[model samples]
Target: MNRGKLNGVAGTTGALCAVVLLGNVMAPDAHAQNSVTLYGVVDAGVTYTSNAGGSNQYALTSGNMGANRWGLRGSEDLGGGLSTIFTLESGFTIANGKFGQNGTFFGRQAFVGLSGSWGAVTLGRQYASSSQFVGPLASGSSWAAPGMGYGTHPADLDNLNSTNRINNSIKFASANYNGLTFGGLYSLGGVAGDFSRNQIYSLAIGYTQGPVKLALGYLNVRNPNYSFWGNKANDSTTASNITSPVIAGYASANTQQVIAAGTSYAIGSATLGAVYSNVRFSGLGATPVAGLSSTAAAYRGSATFNNGELNAKYQVSPALLVGAAFDYMKGNGAGQGGVIYRQFNLGADYFLSKATDFYAVAVFQNASGVDSRGVRAVAAITGATPSTSSSQTVVTAGIRHLF
Candidate 1:
C-alpha cells in the first residue's frame, strides 16, 4: 500500500477509538435515558418475645427485614450539567398489603430534586435531620428484625429512632468539598397563609474519606414531638395554640431541639461506631419550677434531656455478618422517673446469594424507671398487635429477598 493511504487509515482508526470511548462514558445509559424502574422487597415471618406480662404475644408478622415496598425512581438529563431526579417509595404490609404507616402511600419517602455542581434541592416528604444523622450509625446496617431503634434513647431523648420519617418538607444538599458536605431541610406545617407558626428546621454536616465517616446535625421543630413523633402536628388548627409543657432534664412536652454527632471507622472485618446527641425538649424553652400558677400548667407541659450510644458490627465471612450494639440515656429531674433505657442486641445474617438471605436476630432490653420505659429497642422497631404491650426479649428469624 502507498504511504499516504496507510497514514489516512491509521488516523481514521485512532479517531474511531476515541469516539467510542467517549460515547461509553457520556452515554452509558443511552438506552434507558428516560426510563423508570420498579423495584421492591417482600419479607414476612413469625416473631416471639418473652415477658408478655399476661399478654398473648407470639404471632406471625410481616415487613421484617425489608418493608414490603414498591418504588419508582428516574432521572432526566438536561443540557448544560443539569438533571431532574425523583423517587417515590411506599411501604405495605406483606402479610395483608394493608400499607404501612396506617395505609399512607409513599409513607417511606417521596421527593424530587434537581442536581448539578452547586448541589441538589429536594422537595416533598422525607426523613428528619436527627434520623438522617444517627440512623447510619445505629439502624443503617441492621437486618435482624424489629426491636432495633424504635424509641430506646434515655426515654427516647435524641429520637435516634422511633423509626421516624419526615413529611411535608423540602431539603437542600450540598456538593462534596474536601470530604465535607452539608444539608438543610424545612418542613412547612402547610397551613394556608400562616407560615412559621408550626414549622421545622434542620441542618446536617458530614465528612468522609476512605474508611472513616463522621456526621453532626441539628433540628428544631415547634410542637415537634406531637408533630413528627405522634404524627399530630399536621392536624393543628390556627385557633388552637400549642399547649405542650416544657421540663428541663427529661422527657415531657412537644417542643424539641436535638444536636447529634457520630463517627464510624472500618478496620478489615470490623466496623466501630459511637454517637453522642444532646436532646433538649422544653415548652418554649421555659423552665419555671418555683411557684407556678395553675394557669401556666394549663398552657404548657415541659421537659428536657440528653442521650448517647455506642454500636459496632463485623463481617465474619463473605456470606455471614455479626453485629452487637448498646445505648444508655439519662435524665436530670422527675422526667427521669427512673426513665433510663439500655439495649443489647446480637444478630447474624447468612446470605443465600446477592438477592436472598436469612437472618437470626436477638435483642434484650431493660427499662428501669417507668413501667413502659425499656420495652422498645433503640435501633429496632418492635411491631406487634396492640394487645401485646409487654416488652422484652425479642427473637426473630426471617428470610429476605430483593429484586
Candidate 2:
C-alpha cells in the first residue's frame, strides 16, 4: 500500500482504452490452453478546494489515494518446477487524456520474471524500495491526497520524483526467511562515458510475524545535474545544507540519497503504523559562483527535514473499511524553513463484490509555512510539495474494479 501509484493520463491513455475492452485475456474461453487477466481502477471525483488562492476551485480529479488505471498480467507454468510470468501495466486518467511522465507507454509497470523458492529475480520497470517501506508507513501516502498539504517530509521523497517505478533495471526480492526479506535493484546507465550518471540503486528489508510488521530502506541516485526529485537538501534549526535550495535549479551537489525506517502493529480488526524519516541534500560536486566563497554560497541554500506520521484502519465489516491518518513535516534554513505542515485524512470504502468497489475521502492541511496563506492539493498525482498557507481541504469520491 504505497502512497504513489502508476496509473494516470501520462500518455498510455490511448492504449488503456483499447486494453480495457479486451478484458484480461477473454476469461479463458473454451478449448484454450492459455490465460491472461485484465484489471483496472476507474476513480473519478468532484473536488472542492477551500481558500484556493482566494478562490475556491472546484473541479474533477483522478488518482487521488490511488491512480485510475487499467493493466494486463499473465503467466504460464513451464511444468519444470518453474514458471514464466509477465505483466504489462499502463496508466491513464478518466478525467482527461494526458500521458503520465511525458507520454510513457507503460508508466505503471512493464516486466517479465522467473520465480521459484529461491526468491524472485525480476527485470524491466518496477516499484522502488522507498515505496515498499516509507510510503505505506506514512499518513500522506495512505490518506493525504490532493486536499492536504503536499505530504510528509520527503513526501514520497523516496519515490524518486514520483517515479516509484524504475526502467531498464534488474531487481531481486528474496522470500521471507523466518520474518525478514530483502530486496535490491540496479539500473544500468546504458549511456557511454556516464557510468555513474542516471544509475539508480536501492536496498530494502521487510519483516512480518504475527501482529508486527516493520521495514527499513535506503536509496541513492546519481543525477548529473540538480533535480528536486533526487538532489533535495534537508536542513535543521541551526544549519543549512549547501546543495539544495527551496526553489528549483541545477546545482553541483548532484548526488541524492535517503535513509528511512518504519513499523506497524495489528490487533484483531484494527492496525496502527508509524514512520520517521531523515532526509539530506548535499552539493559535493557544486562550484560556487565566481568570487563567491563556499561559505557564502552555503547560507542562501541548504535543507534538513524531519517527517513523522501515525495511521490506523479498521475492518469495520466484511465489505466495508474505514481509516484515518495524520502527518507532520518541517524544514529548516531554506525557503521552506520554519515550514511546518500538519495533515489529516479520513475515508471509507465499500465493496459490491470481490472485484468491484466504491470509495469516498477527504483531506485537510494546516501549516505555518509559505506566508501562512496555505496551498491546497486537489490531486494526489501531482505529488507532494510544501504548503502555501496555514489551512486547506479537499474532498473525493470514486469507483474501482478488478478482474
Candidate 3:
C-alpha cells in the first residue's frame, strides 16, 4: 500500500488523462479542433469594346470571371449545434495590385457571427437581405454572366451583386428549413437626432426545392445619395459616383426603394432563370450636371424603373458551360418618361481544374427613349465605357484561379 500502490494510482490517472485528451481531439464535434482557412481568387482578362468614351478600345482587366481577392474564414464550435464564425474578404485588382471596392481592404465582406440550428446573425459590413436572397437568381449574379460586372441587372441598380455592402449592419439569416430560408438586414445611419436619415434596410425570403429556386425581397434607403456616397461628417459626395448613364442623373434622390423577385429551374444539365425588379427613386433632388444650365432640373421629382431578365445556362460537359441572358428595362419619373433599355449577354467557360477556369463573355446594350433628365439615354455597362450613342458592345476573355 506504499510506493507500489502510489505509483500504480499515478499511472492510472495519467492514462485516463491521455484518453480524455485524445477523445477531445478525435471527438466528432470537438470545439478545440476549430480552424481558420485562407482562400482567394486571382483573375485577369483581355477586353475590347465596340465603343468606349465614343471610340473603340482595348485593355487588360481583373475580376472578369470573378473578383480577385483573398480572405480568411474561421469557425469555432462551442458544443451542441452552435458555433462562432467570422469572415474577412478582400477584393483586389490583380492587374495592378490595387484594392477593389473603393480601396477598402475587406470591401467584399467583413462579418462576425454565431451559427446554430436555427440560423445565423452577423454584424458589420454585409450584403443587404435583398441582394443576399434574390441576387443569385440572376444570370449575371450566377454562372451565365461573368467578367467583372458584365452580367449584373443593367447598372446593377438593384444591388444584385451587392456593390454597396451595408456598413454597420446587423443581419439575420435563417437556416434552411425544408429548402426555405429568409433573412433581414438593418444598417445604422449613425446620424444623431435622425434615425431615418441615411438609413438602409431590407428583407428577403427564398425557397429551393430540387430543380427549382425562388426568391423575393424588398430594400429601402433613406437619403439614397447620402447614404451610399456621402462622407460621414458632412454628407458630402465622395469621389466615386454612379457612372451608368441609365440612372446616374437620378442618383441624388432622398429615398430609393426596390422590390425584386426571381426564379430558376434546373432541367438536366441546363438551368433557366428569370428576374424582375421594380425600383423607385422618390423625394427627388436636383442634380448638378457638369455642363447643364444652372436652372435646369437635371434630376428632380420622382422616377421608377422596371427591369426584367431571362437567362439560361447549359453545362456542355463536366468542364465546359455555355450561357446567355436577355434583359429589358423601362423607366419613368422625374419628368423623364418612357426610357427603355435592351441588353444581351452571352458567355462560356471551360474548367481546367476545380480551382481554375477560362471564360469568355460578350454584352451588348441599346438605349431608347428619354433619360431621367429628359435626354436620350446612353448605353452603359457597369464597368465599361458609356457609349457615345445609344448602343454599345463589349467582349472579354479571361482566366480565374481560386485557392
- Enumerate clash totals for all models, in the order shown: 21, 23, 3
Model 2: per-residue Cα lDDT over 19-50, one tens digit each: 64464367443123144565666556666666
* Best by the TM-score measure: 3
Model 1 global lDDT (CA atoms, 0 to 1): 0.60
TM-score of each: 0.76, 0.75, 0.87
Candidates ranked by TM-score: 3, 1, 2
Could you tell me the lDDT of residue 309 within candidate 3? Answer: 96
Off by over 4 Å in 3: 1-33, 144-147, 229-240, 286-298
> Which lDDT value does model 2 have at 215?
88
Worst 10 residues of 3 by lDDT: 1-10
lDDT of 3 at 3: 16
| RMSD in Å for model 1 | 11.7
